[model samples]
Target chain A: MDFATLLQILDSALRLATPLLLACLAGLFSERAGIFDIGLEGKMLAAAFFSAAYAYITGSVWLGLAAGCIASMVLAGIHGLASITFRGNQLISGVAINFLAAGLTVLIAQNWFEQGGRTPALEGAARFQNITLPFSETLAPVPVIGPIYSQVISGHSALVYIALLAVPATWYILFRTRFGLRLRAVGENPAAVDTSGVSVTGLRFAAVLICGFLCGLAGAYLATGLSANFVKDMSAGRGFIALAALIFAKWRPWHALGACFLFGLLEAFGNRFQNLSVLGVDVPVQLMQALPYVLTVVILAGFVGKAIPPRAGGAPYVKER
Target chain B: MPKWVDVALIPLINLALALAVSMLVILWIGESPFEALAIMVKGAVGSAYGWGYTLYYTTNFIFTGLAVAVAFHARLFNIGGEGQAALGGLGVALVCLAVPWPHWTLALPAAIVGGALFGAAWAAIPAWLQARRGSHIVITTIMFNFIAQALLVYLLVGPLKASGMSPETAPFPDGAALPTAHDIAPWLGFRPSAPLNISFLLALVACAGVWLLIWRTRLGYEIRAFGHSEPAAVYAGIHPTWIIMATMLISGALAGCMAINSVMGEAERLVINSVQGAGFVGIAVALMGRSHPVGVLLAALLFGMLYQGGAELEFEMPAISREMIIVIQALVILFTGALDNMVRMPIEKFYDARRLARQRNGRGTGVAAE
Candidate 1:
């Protein structure tokens, strides 16, 4: 109700929204290219563990970021290999990747650190320290805009800025570029794209790789930026939530950002307020925590306009030739 | 080349591939793969006690696997088995705790009906959304899993806790407990005190019932027809809405039956996190089994071995932790389900080539004799 409280809630919402935003964009690329990637959670989990492990070993956050991306890319490549090259079921491949990541991350972490499937706590250069924006001190003396600039906009990890910037970048690539056109065409109808003399597989593989890159950044931020270490199943269900957000947005990049913020705000409120009462009634905490999922279901069920997926999504393409 | 190949050889080959990869992982972990395999075998089936535990786990997997397989028959992915099973536990707890039954026999049926109804009710929303509103079943079912967990947490912490600090209910009444495997172990010349219970018999009966329903009944025909081709089934006058709703209700009921084993037989209380990833494990089981009742039984037993063996592996070789078993399970699922065509296509091609050579040779001999 108060301004400061509202500002604090918004700040938490932004922080929570960053990972969801990155992952939504990741799914955007994969789905736009006709690949349904339910394994985003698994990819993020793998990236989180590898990033934290490498970061702890090298004491360099940059190296950790690289390792995280590579780890995710490897998984994305495996998914591509299974679903595309082998012409396997995409959902099954995604499920396998989730199980594989859940098991291997903990197994390897135990072998290396012996800390019950967790990486060592990161600090200093090993972690993504918050960046206070320029003129924060000068801005603090200003009126309402001062706190808005310093408190709400500034003091976020660098990855937060990257995630915010990725929205427009994704929009530009998806709607403005030649590759984007090909990607969209491939998802809608691979046969049309193939006849156009563009290799359908190549475009899809490219999109999946970009998905891997963005998911990696999201996972890295969760480990090295938001939290200090990797824990078992730390990605939890964020990947699925991102998928929900993606569907809620109807595959648009800008709408995906809005959806992520909405879900993030729900999560923030759930965390802050254990219980709420409206008028003379009581509202349960479980219902509050479930609001995002409930809303996504309602939206999908045509309470909002129908959320149509890519036409060729989840099907492996095969050329008759 | 034959029906047997698809039914038997393919699964065996996939199992071999998964185990081979697991062996490599073990080697990488600085343990002898042979030793790990030996220990796992001994741990899972070597003793009466081990068999007891294996069968107990097998019971849980079988119920969940059948749940998944039933929905799969109608081309519906019911990923909410975890949630359904959780709610089923709530149902069983409510019935068992609400009234002091005169006997275990009377209480068993009540619990089963209660569990099935609750689980089916949980699944109905997702099924309706998928059938009527065009929402994706996979997404809704998955979301339901999270909501189910949160709901269970709230109940256990608030209304269900029985005057204790722990987030679990008190034990059920004396008459509510199912007969454990220990009661039967003596007559079978086995050791007593294993957790295997009467629910295992129920699982066997359910398997038989599923087999009959799938192979002998008209409804099963409609379900399979719909799964094979939705347009064809629709043209044949089968309503998609009815098929979807009916199939999911059956699936949810089977999933809820798992509570009979974990809640009534083993724990005898409503506990948090009781499902313990068994619902997802059922997906792997159904996949490996190829959705056949007999195959599901076999796959469930194998997973049961992996689970019990994995526990043993941790005790025998600390380097190979329990999570390693999950890695193995994932590999099996990956090979059997996702990469099924990878091995199948090559084998089919090999058989085709061999048959072609035989035919040509026969023709060449006839020409020479003429």
Candidate 2:
């Protein structure tokens, strides 16, 4: 492939990676707090629909983002009420929430728009436009660094930059803050945290709510930023892919960005070359699409490196006293 | 306080709550919920035609629900039912297409064996991973689901595709066709086109078999023992790996058997997306049924009605789409499975107070409540 083609692929990869990166960070927080949320996909889907719908109605992207975030947070709150307060099985609650979001989005969309569960395409102010950074015109003359900086890095929606920025912010919050220490302690040993007079429930809820907010940003990016409107099931298993990326990252903030970008690059290539072959043998498009899942399974099976989860992950806490 | 309350009354109340939510949703969409209900009941069970479709759908749910319940008994969440069912469908297609037998009686047995084996094999890797490698079965099984989807697509459009451009195989051999409800009992005056088949009977037999295995056998005891407490079970000389592997195999086999209803009985061919979302619906059924075979049967029937009725509901009222069924199913799962204690707590408090009052009045403990 030519350098231009490679740069173009990287640009799309950056765009695609934005949503996955945000969603991965979302899972990182929730899972780090011992709240294993399989509802990430559902929240993203619901948020995508609401964001697009509100953006179309008000012709304001900011309002759409707000609506999307609220929708996701509401789902997360329901999850907390079930898994945290009621002490129900976390997996079952996650499954229920996913179905709720999946069904509600399509049902409401069909009822409101009659457009087969899709919002009308956003125009002008309802959509996020790509921003080209300064000195791109002058930077074009420079060799390798110019195109990589200007073309590949500069031209993306604001959400892309935000997602990239969130990685470092996530690192700082999780590893360098007192709240982060308490959050990790809760996930690892809630009974210990409880004995210390820290509210385990409170910390977990904070983590889950933050998860919702990040997922909301991911969904909003999917609908208005990456594309102009919401399509039914447009998240398209990205939430699960993000979850897989979380596992691949060993639940670390910085590692999550690398994992998501790798998956995104694979996706970009799969999109670009359906029939391209390096060897004499034919490669099917489906195999390319299935690679991430297969790779994750291998990783999970411990053939590569160990990817252990939090000590108390997927368990509902009960007071020892 | 009573076993009967847990088995019957609690689920019934939860179901009521779910239906109530559905009603509100219908109202929100500017449709009359009562009229919609009437239409759904009529469309799902008022006629033999509707019953046929409902029972047909019920058969599939029974297999999938039992599949989930079996794994759940061993404390394993087999969320990969959708993928397992697809692979089972692949097995059915292979067996049915392999030979031109003169009778379905012969074909059915071969298909069952093939389907079960394929389903079990598909689950084996994930189970082994959880058993020996300490990998999370939940994540691996889910990944296997995506892989299964891709594999099915690859097989269909490549080696398995028929003469047409469509990504499905040609019909199974004529002899492999199972008898429909109308064929079995023409005196009932059912339409020949009704999809209900002998697979419904097979589903009941499987349910009975599962009930026997779970409650009447030693392996069942071990599974229950492991689920209740792994450390205790391990101390009792039961191997955790053995229980996990055996339970998952049975679960996958049952899930795979669902293809017999949709593929061999009705479609008579291997098709893309044939399982649709029936596999996921099994989770709701298993949860609502409390993972008991009898409960699974009842829950599967209710869902079947929802499936058939929701189709009719959409036909009668465009305002309420078919996706409305999923919403109702979700509510049912949420109330019955996740927020079960929400209702359980208040009921427990009320029952406890009444019991204490009765005891204080010198009524014996075993007396039935008036």
Candidate 3:
């Protein structure tokens, strides 16, 4: 492939990786606090639909993004109420939220848009544009890897940069902050944290709400950054993929960032292979589509050495008398 | 009140809560909530034909529910029922079309056995991975669902494509089709056109078989013991790992039965999308049934009513969105999971009060005698 094309592919890979990165990081926070947040997909889906709908109505992408975050936070609040406050089973509550989001999004979309799904196509102003990094254009004429650096590293939506920024930020917050220590303590042993006068429920609820905000951004990125409009089920197992990444990363933010990129690269390569009919060894489109999921299984089975989830990951915490 | 009455009250409260949530959703869509609910009820159990269709759908759910419940009994979640059922349907379809069996008795059993084996094999991969590699079953099963969908799509469109047709297999031979009671519909006083068949009877038999296996057999004891406390089971020399694998195989076999409904009983052909979402719905059914065989059967029938009723709502009440059914299902699960815990305290208090009253009465009688 030409250098320009290679650069284009890399750029596309990074852009595609943004949503998974953000969502995986979001999951990292909640799960690190010992809550299994399977509802990430549902939160993202709900946010994406609402964002696109708001964008379609007000012609303001900013408002749409804000609305998306608010919608996701609301979902997170409900999850927190059920699983954290009421001490319900985290897995079941997460599943319920997923079902609720899946059904509610479709119902409301059908009601308002009058289409089974899908809002109107968005205009350029309503979508985020690529940022041209300084000196990149002039540097593009140099060598074989120049175009790769220029295209892949230079022009992209703001979310890509933000996602990259989140890795270190999450690390700093998780390992270097008092709040992070408290969150971890709550997850590992709520009673101990309670004895120390730290409110376990409050900390976990905050962690979940933070997850909601991040997931909302991830959803907005999908709808407004990656595509012009939202499609039904468009979040489409990405949440699960993010969860896999969290496990594969062993619940560490920087590791999860790497895992998300790897998954994103597999997806991008799968798409590339679909277009190539190599010497009568053409792969079926469906198989190409299934490649990432297969790779996820293989990696988790073989390479994810040992997953040590939070000590209290799915256990409901109740105060001991 | 009676103990059975107390037991019944929880589910009823859950149902009522779910209904109230669904009504709010219906009202949000600018439809009369009462009218929409009326349509759902009328469509589900209002007529004999409706009952038949409900049973037909329930057959698949019962099989899948049993699959999930059996796995839950071993403390293993078999989320791969989606993939297993797909693989099962593929097995049945391939055998029905490719194998030559002159007798119906032989062909039918062969098809079912083929399906069960395929389903079992599909589930065994995840089970093996989990047992050996420390991989979580939930992630593995979710990944397997995507793989199965891709494999089915590839097979349907490529090698198994019925000549000159769409992406589906050819129809099964007469020997393979499950004998339906539709021909005897007139004598049975039911609609002649209903799609109800012998699969419903097979499902009921399977339910009874599962109940017997779970309650009456040594293996069932091992499975339940493992579920209740894995460490204790291991201490008791039950080999919890092997039991888990065996439970997955049994669950897969039950899911395979669901394939018979689609491949041999209903469609008589392998549609690539035939598995639908029944496998996931089975999880909800198992949970609502509290992982009991009889409870799974009842829960499956209730879901079947929802499915049949949802379709009718679309036809009868044009203004009501058919997707309301999914909303209601979500609410049911929410209530089932939440209300289950919510009722525990109250029920315990009631029983404690009854015990205290009996103790007071006994003391008074003793004192009077003295």
Task: Report i-RMS for every model.
Answer: 1.1, 0.9, 2.1
Evaluate residue A254 in candidate 2 and report its C-alpha lDDT on the 0 to 100 scale: 91
Q: Write the per-residue lDDT of candidate 1 for residues B82-109, one digit (tens) a residue.
A: 9999988888888889898778899899
The lDDT values for all models are: 0.91, 0.92, 0.82
How high is the lDDT of residue A195 in model 3? 95
Model 2 agreement with the true structure over B233-275: per-residue lDDT tens digits: 9999999999999999999999899999999999999999888
- Best candidate according to DockQ: 2
Give the candidate order by descending lDDT: 2, 1, 3
Error in Å for residue A55 of model 3: 1.5
DockQ of 1: 0.75
lDDT of candidate 3 at residue B246, scale 0 to 100: 87
**Candidate 2 error regions (>4 Å):** B353-370
